[model samples]
Structures are given as structure tokens and as C-alpha cells.
Target: MSQQQCACPKCDCSVDSQAIEKNGQRYCCEACAIGHTDGSTDCGHNCQCGK
Candidate 1:
């Protein structure tokens, strides 16, 4: 089986086995999923720089 990858363009984190789906796009987490919703770079978090 092939491992799935995060659909977030600003993020390169892998989704591993389970991928968070939002509007047909896959993400690693809720932050990433929501961030990419508006096509903005803001991930609603202050962990990673410019995430």
C-alpha cells in the first residue's frame, strides 16, 4: 500500500494512514485543512513559521 500525503500546499507533512479530507482535499490535520480553505497561508496556529 502507498502512504498518503498531505494536500496542504504550504505544508509538507505526511498524512500517514489517515488523511483529513475537506472539500475533496486531503490534509494532515484540522489546522492545515482549515487554513487552506480560503487559499490563504494562515494556518490559524503559531507553531510553524508562515504555516
Candidate 2:
């Protein structure tokens, strides 16, 4: 089967993947799916998000 290109639900960006389901739901990347939840944190062990 051929690959499908779709836009991210959080951010409008093209993503190529062959595993997309028929629901049209897709995530460009794990980072994008995570979203601003991490933005509040500093990405360090001291970050509250990690807690």
C-alpha cells in the first residue's frame, strides 16, 4: 500500500505515514501531540511536568 499524507491535529503540518487509520485522525509527531503541556516546563529534572 502507498503512504498517506495528513496534517497534524494540534499543528497544521504535513506528515507522511502508512499506518494512519480510516478515521482520518493523525499526529505529526509525539512531540506535537504532547503540545504546550511541556511548554510550561523547562524539560529538566526540576520541571513540574515530570512530576
Candidate 3:
């Protein structure tokens, strides 16, 4: 499969096999998948959005 950016609008992290799926959308991590609704500001990845 091809790589794609996280579903989160603020995140630019790429997702692969570790991608987190939510409602048909793929994210880099759980944080992004849930739209950081848990008060998280990052996806726990080494990316600009997570910084």
C-alpha cells in the first residue's frame, strides 16, 4: 500500500502499517485518530505537528 499523511488536519506525519484507523480515516497515532480530544496536542511522533 502507499503512504499517506495522518487524518488530523494539523498533523503532517506519514502513516503506514502502524496507522490508526478511525471512521475510515487513517492516522499516524491514536492521538491523531481521536483528533486529540483527550487534550493531547501531538500524535507522539517525531513531526512538526507533534512538536
Candidate 4:
């Protein structure tokens, strides 16, 4: 199956098989799923989409 992009509008990372699902949306990490509540855009990955 093809990987899906993160649900976050600013995130360009791809969601793997273990993608984090929140409210029926798939995210690359918790930060994306929570809409960067802490004002942090880092998803513990290399990409700096939220920067």
C-alpha cells in the first residue's frame, strides 16, 4: 500500500503503517494529531515542516 501524507497542513512527512490516528485523521506524529498544541511543530522527524 502507498504511504499517506500527514494530516497536518504544514507537515510534509509520510505516514507509515503505524500512523497515528486521531479523530479519523492520520498523522505522522502526536504533535501533528494534536495540532501542535504546545506550539511545537517538530514531530521527532527530520523534516521541519512546522518551522
Best candidate (score: TM-score): 3
- Residue 5's lDDT in candidate 4: 93
The residue pairs that clash in candidate 1, if any, are none
Give the alpha carbon lDDT tens digit for every residue of 1-50 in model 1: 46676676656566655777889877777767777455555444433513
Please tell me which model should have the higher lDDT, number 2 or number 3. Answer: 3
Q: Which ten residues in a row have the lowest lDDT in candidate 3?
A: 42-51
Off by over 4 Å in 1: 36-50
Q: State every prediction's TM-score relative to the real structure.
A: 0.57, 0.34, 0.82, 0.81
lDDT of 4 by residue, 1-51 (tens): 699999988888899889999999899988888888878858888766666
Model 4 / residue 50 / CA error / Å: 3.1
What's the ranking of the predictions by TM-score, best on top?
Answer: 3, 4, 1, 2
Question: Which parts of model 4 are misplaced by more than 4 Å?
Answer: none
Candidate 2: segments with Cα more than 4 A from true spot: 1-10, 18-24, 40-51
lDDT of 2: 0.39
Candidate 3, residue 32: how far the Cα is off, in Å: 0.7
Error of 2 at 24 (Å): 7.6
lDDT score at residue 14, model 2, on the 0-100 scale? 49
Better of 1 and 4 by lDDT: 4
Q: Least accurate stretch of 10 residues (summed lDDT) in model 1?
A: 42-51
TM-score of 4: 0.81
